[model samples]
Target: MKIIEKMNIEKLNVIYQIFNEKDLLRKLSHQGIIKLHNFFQDENYVYLVTELANRGDLGFLIKNVSPLAINKSMIQFIIAELLMPLEYLHSIGVSHRDLKPENVFVTEEGHLKL
Candidate 1:
């Protein structure tokens, strides 16, 4: 769940960005992308309910795992998984501006989610 405080949104002047993100998430329907289940705004905050990536994110996995354990094939697989969604998004005329390890989540079955 993402809780965006109304005050912070106003302070940061990111109301448009937030709305853009919400729209993008709503339009996206790929296995590698995070699923937005619901969205609502109250008096104090905006709530975004999304799918859970129980295995956490790519950054967490990279930091916790040994470098030697990450083989070339594993790297390729991760990259391929990441690229699939990018390709899909591109085909649909969308570009993800923020692409990073922290933004890539790992699913319980060891699949990657953008």
Candidate 2:
């Protein structure tokens, strides 16, 4: 999937810093975090080509599906799946500054990626 992040020219330096740290970004790949495949920029936006989450994000999915629709096993699975990457990030002194259901995605295979 492709995502475009827009920022003012003043924030250009921030984007460059992020892109320049490709090794750090690659090291962050895990079960729960979205993998960064490639990145580029034009005049106004930074383009990221990343893995596709066919099931979309967790926030919108929860809105459309009732909580009761999910069984005990599924809840347990999601919690278990999310924990590893969360722990791994923290262990490496990284904090997910923006963590919300919107930032978590579900794969077609019933797994979660943050």
Candidate 3:
């Protein structure tokens, strides 16, 4: 497909995966990071609307790990920040079941909140 067509298909696929409103909410809520905006179905299709984070996931950052010198505190901060999602999910009775360096994400504020 052309680039534009491929992009549209991706968006549609995201919408189709939800199955329904309830499923979408449960799934997105469990994403541990991104904020879902809305999910709906109209006649022949389902749609999922969510806040788009251009920075991408933790997997990307980990793959691009920097070689520059860093302090121990920085490492500790990264670990804690990434673990917060796992902690919050578990507290809510949800287990990520797939916790790993790839499943984390760092937001733009340098807060490592995700």
Question: lDDT of all the models against the reference?
Answer: 0.92, 0.75, 0.53
Q: Using Cα atoms with residue i matched to residue i, what is each candidate's TM-score against the true structure?
A: 0.89, 0.77, 0.53
lDDT of 3: 0.53
Give a tens-digit lDDT track for model 3, residues 1-114. 001233554667743433443353445453345565665555554455555545556667656768463558778987777677667766767555556655454556654423
Better of 2 and 3 by lDDT: 2
Weakest lDDT window of 10 consecutive positions for candidate 1? 94-103
Sorted by TM-score, highest first, which candidate order results?
1, 2, 3
lDDT of 3 at 19: 48
The RMSD of every model to the true structure, in order and in angstroms, is 1.5, 2.9, 6.4
Whole-model alpha-carbon lDDT for candidate 2: 0.75
Q: Where is model 3 more than 4 Å wrong at Cα?
A: 1-32, 40-48, 69-71
Question: Which 10 successive residues of model 2 have the least lDDT summed?
Answer: 1-10
Candidate 3 accuracy as TM-score: 0.53
User: How many steric overlaps are in each model, in order?
Assistant: 0, 1, 1
Residue 61, model 2: lDDT of 83
lDDT of 1 by residue, 3-106 (tens): 99999999999999999999899989999889999999999999988899899899999999999989999899999999999999999998889898988989
lDDT of candidate 2 at residue 102, scale 0 to 100: 88
